[model samples]
Target: MTTPSARVVLKPKRARPLFAGHPWVFAQSIARVEGSPEPGDEVEVVSHEGATVGRGLFNPSSAIRARLYRWDGGPLDDAFWKARLETAVQLRRDVLGLDARNSAYRLVFSEGDGLSGLTVDRYGSCLVALFSSLALHRRRDAILDALRELTGAEGIIARPDRAVAKEEGLDVGDVRIVGTIPEDLTVFENGLSYKVDVLQGQKTGFYCDQRENREAVARYCLGKRVLDLFCFTGGFALNAAKAGAASVRAVDSSAPALATARENARINEVANVEFEQGDVPKILERLKAAGERFDVVICDPPKYAGHARDLAPALGAYARLNHAAVDVLSPGGILATCSCSGLVDRATFRDVLANVAEHSRRPVQILEQRGQGPDHPVSAPCPETDYLKCLIARVG
Candidate 1:
């Protein structure tokens, strides 16, 4: 590797995790800096005893002061970025064959693919890239060039993750377009079609991570009354309806999302789904008051806890949602609930379910515990990459 601009020395006995493959080197773990390394600059990580741990990006303002992507002390050069992008694409195209079955899926999942702070999701012919690392953001030209060559994507849409930019003290601009991107883009999965608004929609226009969980939960929807809460683009509801559910009622607060979902239903000729635009919990209460019950209920919510501090409230919110879901579920019905908060681990999520069962006075049996699709592979060292949790349970 080229000589680093600076060297970060870790505190005593703090080098094990970085050596064992954890990618983060927090400010607290750092003892001193030999030279002034500006944010996004490549720096060598060293032990107090002068052992070189590796090299990584330095961001003093963030709690995760550094993000280590190289254990071999390789240079973060043009060739390095190209090779990383190629590996991510090859996993999806060759190893998983995700393109044969689905058009929209996560091509690169930041730390999951060993490229920290960069996430790329493919929406048909166009690719949406979100840069959370200043190093990668500053090197967008090279990143985009490598991606284009690797994926043959017509164009790229580089959007800013506002929250991340703020956390890292970055100056993120508006959306950038590299080449041609079609306005009317559609993605197919599990033989179902959905309209995607990559430019103005949420998180690259679709929830590509839930592609597999949608199918797994649909197995119990056949010949049943289904309720899909937070049904963004009606993924679960549409899958349930396609699986021969007797009827499907989907709810989401975003009108545009519901509109696109309705359009998706229309395109698929799905007549069993009824779209509703309103708060999910309030709608659940209304359904309970009307003496309505469903054989299956899906509660796939947004990320409630993005950080450690929000975990308590996130679990409480989950408990309340699950309790309400049980209120309208038929005896011995299925409840497919999910959480995309990386900070909320599986054990803590189970505790939330436990609280729901205790208060709702219903026995909740976990039928299956699933996660994001194969395309969104989890890096063993970075547990945060395994964020999406779909717990298929039978409530009795």
Candidate 2:
């Protein structure tokens, strides 16, 4: 018998999701490997019936055996990659008009932008590109070239996703810098200025995903005392303070992030925001004891669940923090809570909030449910891209 070459054959009935346009192919669903394929190599995916499903980057180290990029069985060459990159850029620039309003925004949202495992956020003239896949990381040079040409960026910084290094078998060492990067990079969002440290700051120097949410949540902050927990770089706090909030108190564990937030406040002349650095749970406990209350509270914490196994504990932690938030919330107060973990779906997080309502015995009325902004577009076929869950509710 002749060899079928390097390809991944799916088990019976496992091709449904791939056929449905889902990008990831789990190892468990794979029936067999027809040929030996190196990591980050282009390989075809086939069903048990010998029908060609698609072709994508094959990674044996990660649980996701393959991340298919094309459904029409196209080649993933440099031109193909550049076309995908251009499409992502066009969405932010032409479709969303993100650049016309804000200099800092998500340019490419990994799987959300059809480029699985790669995300590029523009921080003013400096562009920060994060590589989550070995295949994408290998093609950083070509990708950065396309990005620089498309955006006319002054500098490009290629950073590794250290969180996924172990799982994805990545080498997390140093960041590759191209072109000239300003020592002090600042970005504007919703009429607020923030100093971004692309080399040292959190998640590409800023959390641009919450840009719209900050503006939306601040509307309720006017003439109300607002508390922002896990307020990294004071995104929600500054917005609330600027929106005429009575006073804003923000808490975070990272001293560097708080320092940046304080600096942002200083530069923007926003003096109403007071930043406290400490563990959030302990701070929440202290606030409850102090009998402090706020009319509007924003809880935007870091990712609690990194994997499926951590989902239970993440839920427990969320329930604890939210219950504590409810403790400090006044009757009929607004609570803007958020979860960044993709594993914690909207339904599951809602279930947690339901439990919180039952335990605290408070009437929970959901005002609006939001997700990552349009810049972080969600692929309908890939629900995993829709990771963020923001719930603005009234707690009694």
Candidate 3:
């Protein structure tokens, strides 16, 4: 008869607006299943009205039940991959003008580019591809082939070190796809050089998401003695020092990241920065106890909340970090704080900062607020569209 169909049919309530182009289908929204489907199974998503909405990978265990890859009812063959890969490359070149810059940039940004859960970063001649979803990991050969055929860059490497893969029930592994991917590479941003450790560093070697934020911070850091807390690879510290900061101390627990941070400073020939490897909380405590104050402080911590349940503890961490940051700020000094946790919305982050200021008894005025750079665009209807939230405030 018919090949045993594996698909999900949404209920009326579940399908109401999903057909409107939302990429995510929540687990609670699933109404019925036509046949047995394993996690990461490719399926046809249908509305209650019996209209096909899209083709996606189904992950029953995940809150995100389905991640839509193509809304048009079409075969996902080699042609589809070729077209999507080309479009992804062209978007960066045509829309973001990435060709004019030699610095690293996101080649693919998951759902933002309509390719769910696939992230790629280009560092000089090297490429780091992150395949977090089982759907993409299964098709790793084709994806790698597309990268080789399309970009023709020097090298392509796989970065499955991210935690997202574990949620998809996949084991993490690092694979070298093509060419010679170095252990350490250098990237230029805003005329400053940063040494990136692709094998061990965070998210595809460098924080491409913070490109614009670093540029903005560089504008205000001149003549300031800055303290960068939770400074992985010292992106902010380098920016601040390159902007003529009197001095900068970059702190992180990973000695490897700090070592790269030091090399990054040296690459830029910026001599004013110092790297300290330790726990950020303890370091902050010691600094405050030592009566050491800074004219500018940057707190860019990792994701404290991966989900809604983690928000309480995340807020506590944010508050404690900002409290110490504020306590050691010189009068009228600036504090640039950021939270990468998608669960921590802008409102919640601002509230926590205000609470920190209140607790520290410091008079604070917010100078500016920013989200992820233009490269990381947000969809209007999706709350998850925005992730990075940063606040630049002056404390007295």
**TM-scores for all predictions:** 0.97, 0.98, 0.94
Off by over 4 Å in 1: none
Candidate 2 lDDT over residue span 1-396, tens digit each = 122258999999999889888999999999999889998888889999989898888899999999998878678888888999999988888889988999989998998888988989998888998888987888888899999999999999997787887788788775799999899888899999999998888778899999999999999999999999999998999999999999999999999999999999999999888899999889989999999999998999889999889999999999998999999999999999999999999999898789889999999999999999999998998888889999999998
The candidate with the higher lDDT, 1 or 3, is 1
lDDT of 2 at 214: 95
Residue 46's lDDT within candidate 1 is 91
User: Given candidate 2, what's the lDDT at residue 69?
Assistant: 89
Per-residue lDDT of 1-396 in model 3, one digit per residue for the tens?
122158788878677566766788887788888888887677888888888888888777677778787776776666787788888888888988976874788887776777777888888788898887777677778888888788888888885646786787667764656888876677888787788778777778788888888878777789999999888887898889888899999899988888888887777788888899899989888998999999999989889998879989999988988988888889989999999998889998999877977788888888889988766767664567699998998888
List the candidate 2 regions with Cα displacement exceeding 4 Å. Answer: 1-5
Q: Flag clash pairs in model 1.
A: none
Q: What lDDT score is found at residue 304 in candidate 1?
A: 96
How many Å off is the CA of 176 in candidate 1? Answer: 1.5
Q: Write the per-residue lDDT of candidate 1 for residues 198-225, one digit (tens) a residue.
A: 8888877899889889999899998999
Error of 1 at 389 (Å): 0.9
